[model samples]
Every structure is written in structure tokens, then in C-alpha cells.
Target: MARLTILLVVLVAAMATAFAPVPLSRTVSTTALNGQTRVEVKIGEGEPIESALRRFKREVNKSGHLMDLRHKRYFENSQDRKKRKIVQARIRKRLERMNARRMRQRRS
Candidate 1:
């Protein structure tokens, strides 16, 4: 009878521990330099790592930057080289702004 009570207590404790979820960061980002893509993801704070990664992958895929790269190179010719530099500069500027915003939030 004592052994049965102990077993029941152990089972309940194990079950409680097993169902507990680890608290995780809600913000995740992935930057692909080759593709010139930076994705910012938010999953409402406390989502699992798996969910964050999945959402990151989905955002990257949906960004269309990969397909844009396939159809177009950042620089293909002399004329395009000039334009590519301009476009690249613009993209870099945008990413810098985003990074700054993230930093500001982190500080707070």
C-alpha cells in the first residue's frame, strides 16, 4: 500500500514535468547575405524554437528575393554594374535602419 502511494506520486510528478514548456524568445531573425535578405519574425513571445525557425524559413521563402536573384543578377554588365551598386546601397541602407530599430528596442 505504501509502494502504491509512492508510485502514484512519482507518476504525477513526472507527468507535470513532461508537459511543462520552456519559455523562449519571441523575436528571431535570419540574414542571408548572398540573397540580400533579412527577415524579422515575431511569434507573440514564448513560442518554441521550432516554431520560430519554421516561421523564419517561411518568411525567407515568401520574400521572393531568391526568385528575383534567379531572374536577375545584382550586376550583369557595365551598365547594370552602376545600377546594381545603387540598388545594393539602397538595400544595405534599409537593413541598417532595421538593425538600429532592433537595437533600440533591445536597449529598452
Candidate 2:
């Protein structure tokens, strides 16, 4: 009886997963100067195209492919790349400091 019950439970779980509804994913491929990258977004059944497009844009931004493509569009010398990185780091640090100051003021 115990084995039969366990088998029935396992069978039910398998069937449930097998019949589960999976969202359809659409892939958008972008070709960069270096190579190609793909971003995928899932669209649920009956979902509107506008929302799906928004989701796709979010995914692409999160993946950094668009920014990467822009960066790769131009060839930068090593010295220029290093200078850009330094400037970015400085800006990032300044923003972090500003945020910290804001947090301190809020606590007070």
C-alpha cells in the first residue's frame, strides 16, 4: 500500500509538470562589429505586443548588449580606453558618495 501510494504521487507530479504551461520565448539577435548576441524574452499567452516589446527592451538593457555594441562601434586605443575607465570610476565614486550623504541626512 505504501509503495503504491508513493508511485501514484510521483506519477501525478510528473504529469502535472509535463502539462504545465510554459511561456513562449522570442529571441532577438543583434550583430555587433565583433560578433552576434541574442536576447530572449518570454511572452505569456494572450500578452500584448507592446508589453512584450517593453520586456525585450528591458532584457537587452539588462544584458548590456546595446551599450556593448555602441562601445564596439568605435575602436579605442589602449590609452583612450584607460582614460575612459578612470573617468567612469571617478563618476561612480562621486555618485556613491552623494548617495551616502543623502542616506546620512535622511537618518538625521
Candidate 3:
């Protein structure tokens, strides 16, 4: 009698699950970039809708799509770009030297 009851319960549970509708959201895709595998994820079932967009944005950032868009947003001559980069590099080096000096002083 206990066995029969357990079997009936399992059968009913299976039927309920089979008939229950499952909501699925699509936000998973695989892409190949320069022979490298890239997996992107988005929001899915039981996840907030806003999180899906955030995931997409993060994926774009990982793929450097956001950087590309920003670069293409303005028209700049190659020479100007090079000059800008040189100035930025100079500033970065100066900052690095200053940081190193500060660190050495602290250690001493």
C-alpha cells in the first residue's frame, strides 16, 4: 500500500511537470574571434530584464565593441591620433615615475 501511494505520487508529479510551461529567455551565444572562442551571456529565466541588458553591455565591453564605437564616433586624422597617444604616454610615464619615487620613500 505504501509503495502504491509513492508510485502514484511520483506519477502525478511527473504529469504536473510535463504539463507546466517553462519560460525561457535567450541570451546565450558562442562566437569565434580570430580563432579564439568567445562566449557571451545574457539574462535568462527568473532573471531581471534589466540584468539582460547589463549582461549584453558587459559582453560588448569584453569584445571591445564599446571601444570601437567610441573610436568611430569621431573623425580624427592619424597624425593627430598618434600625437595624442604620445602625449598620453608621456603623462603616464611621469605618473609612474612619481609613484615609484613615493613607494621608495615609503619603504625607506
Candidate 4:
């Protein structure tokens, strides 16, 4: 009986871990040239788009924001600007995907 109880407990623990929800965070990368730099950010799952984006926008626009173009003159380079645009597009796409996922989850 003791062994059976232990086995049941172990099984439950394993199941919980296996089915646990995974929370993901945003990823950002940055590089600089002689006069300009580039930054990239990738968002992950876990929260609604509005909240995640609000956090992102706040951080990006903050005075010390790592990717701030004005603060980081090196990032003002044309190449760096292009990379920033690409990263921004990725962020928007991620938001759309997140919304779709949430809707599907709600339906189920």
C-alpha cells in the first residue's frame, strides 16, 4: 500500500510537470558600428500583447533604454536603423500570434 501511494504521488508530480504552462520572455540583441548600432528583440509567450508591448515600449522609450537611437549614436547608422525596423516588425508579428493563441485557448 505504501509503495502504491508513493507511485501515485510520483505519477501525479510527473503529470503536473509535463502539462505545466511554459512562460516565455522577449529576446533582444544589439550591435554597434563605428557611428551606429543595431538592436533586435524577440518576444515570447506568457502574457497578453498589450501588457507585453506596453512593457516593451516603456523600456524602449525610457531614458536609458539600451536601444534608444538618440542615446546610442552608433545605432543611428542606416544599417542599424534597418535592423531596428525588422525587429519591430517581428514584435508586431509576435503580438498577432499571441492573440490567436489566446483565442484558441479560450475556445477550448
Candidate 5:
């Protein structure tokens, strides 16, 4: 009788598990660079592969890993680095001024 009850319990548990809603599985992959940056994307069970690839590319671009890698590919001295930073700052300031002027003109 005990063996029969055990078998029944097992059978009920199996049925319950079989009927339970199964979650959609996702595939994830991560690429790490220098142990500092990682880009990851998950593809759902029904999601299109093209969409998943697009999402991965977007994530990579958004993370700036490619840019960082490019910048670090070559060695730059302190003076060169400082010059580059100054040029970037000047460009940023110019853009900000242009934007502010546009806003002021729009207000008029």
C-alpha cells in the first residue's frame, strides 16, 4: 500500500509539472574586454535572429567598447592626450553655444 501511495504521489507530481506553464527560454552571450567591459544580449525563444543581432550591435555601440578599443589601440603621450582633450572641449563648447543660440532665437 505504501509503495502504491508513493507511485501515485510521483504520478501526480509528474502530471502537475507536465501541465505547468513553461517559461520561454532565452539565449545569452557575453564578451568581455580587459575584464572591465562586457556586452550582453538575450534572444528569446520566438524572437527573430536578425532582431537579436541588431540588439547586440546596438548594445555594443551604446557601451562605447569599440570606441574605447580604437582609442587604446595605439600609444599616445601625455601632451598629445592633453591636446586631444582640449580640441574635444573646444568642439563641445562650440556646439553648446550653437544650441543655446538656437534656443534663444526660437524664444524670440
Candidate 6:
């Protein structure tokens, strides 16, 4: 009878845990200061601290946190923004041409 009670308790606990709603992903908390953004990662059970930190950094990078901070660091007038955009487009075109040339040379 005592063994039966213990077994029942164990099964109940297991069912409770199994039916609990699981979070899809760990929460990412961000803080910004002095034009830089910092990310805090909560390490999960059995997760290495270094691996968690690395993953957090990767997530931040993929989300453009650093790029956003960089763009926000200085005020840009409309003219300046336009000029920068033009320069970037030119540079992009130049790079594409160079890459195409390299590819053609490689094919020869």
C-alpha cells in the first residue's frame, strides 16, 4: 500500500511536469548605453556559460543590434545621409564589378 502511494505521487508529479507549458525560447534582455548595446543571456540548465555568451553575441549580431548602435552614434543631416548612400552604392557597384572580373579570370 505504501509503495502504491509513492508510485501514484511520482506519476502525478511526472504528469504535471509533462503537461506544463514550455517557453519557445529563452528571453533576451538588452541594455543600451553610450551608443553601445549589451545583451544579457540567462543560461539554461546544463548549458556552459561560455557557450551561452557566445550564442547571445551571435543573436545580437544577427539582429543588427551593433549596426543600429553604430548608425545611431552620430546625427546625420539629410544631405549627409544622401551623400553617404550614394557613396555606398558606388562602392557596392565597384565591388560587384571586381568580383565579376575575378570570376571571369578564374574561368579562363
Best by lDDT: 6
| Ranked by TM-score, top first | 2, 5, 6, 3, 4, 1
Q: What is the lDDT of residue 68 in candidate 5?
A: 71
lDDT of each: 0.77, 0.79, 0.77, 0.69, 0.80, 0.80
lDDT of residue 106 for candidate 2: 100
Residue 99 CA displacement from its true place in model 3, Å: 1.4
Q: For each candidate, how many residue pairs have backbone atoms clashing (under 3 Å)? A: 0, 0, 0, 5, 0, 0
Per-residue alpha-carbon lDDT of model 2 for 1-108, expressed as tens digits? 999999999889888855665546554444445476777666767889898899888878977877877877999889988998999899999999999999999999
After superposition, the stretches of candidate 3 with alpha carbons farther than 4 Å from their true spots are: 1-68
Residues 61-82, model 1: lDDT tens digits: 8887776777475547778768
Tens digit per residue, CA lDDT, model 5, 1-108: 999999999889888855666545343445666777777676777889898888889878887878878878999889988998899899999999999999999999
lDDT of 5: 0.80
User: What ranking emerges by lDDT with the best candidate at the front?
Assistant: 6, 5, 2, 1, 3, 4
Per-residue accuracy of model 3 over 53-103 as CA lDDT, tens digit each: 777766767786556567768998999889978998999999999999999
lDDT of 3: 0.77
- Candidate 5 has what TM-score? 0.54
For model 3 the local lDDT of residue 51 reads: 82
Score residue 41 of candidate 2 by CA lDDT: 68
Per-candidate TM vs. native? 0.31, 0.60, 0.40, 0.31, 0.54, 0.44
Model 4 clashing residue pairs (backbone): 35-74, 36-74, 36-75, 37-74, 37-75
Per-residue lDDT tens digits for candidate 4, residues 1-108, read 999999999899888855665445655445556755445445675557787677666655553445464546653778877887899899999999999999999999
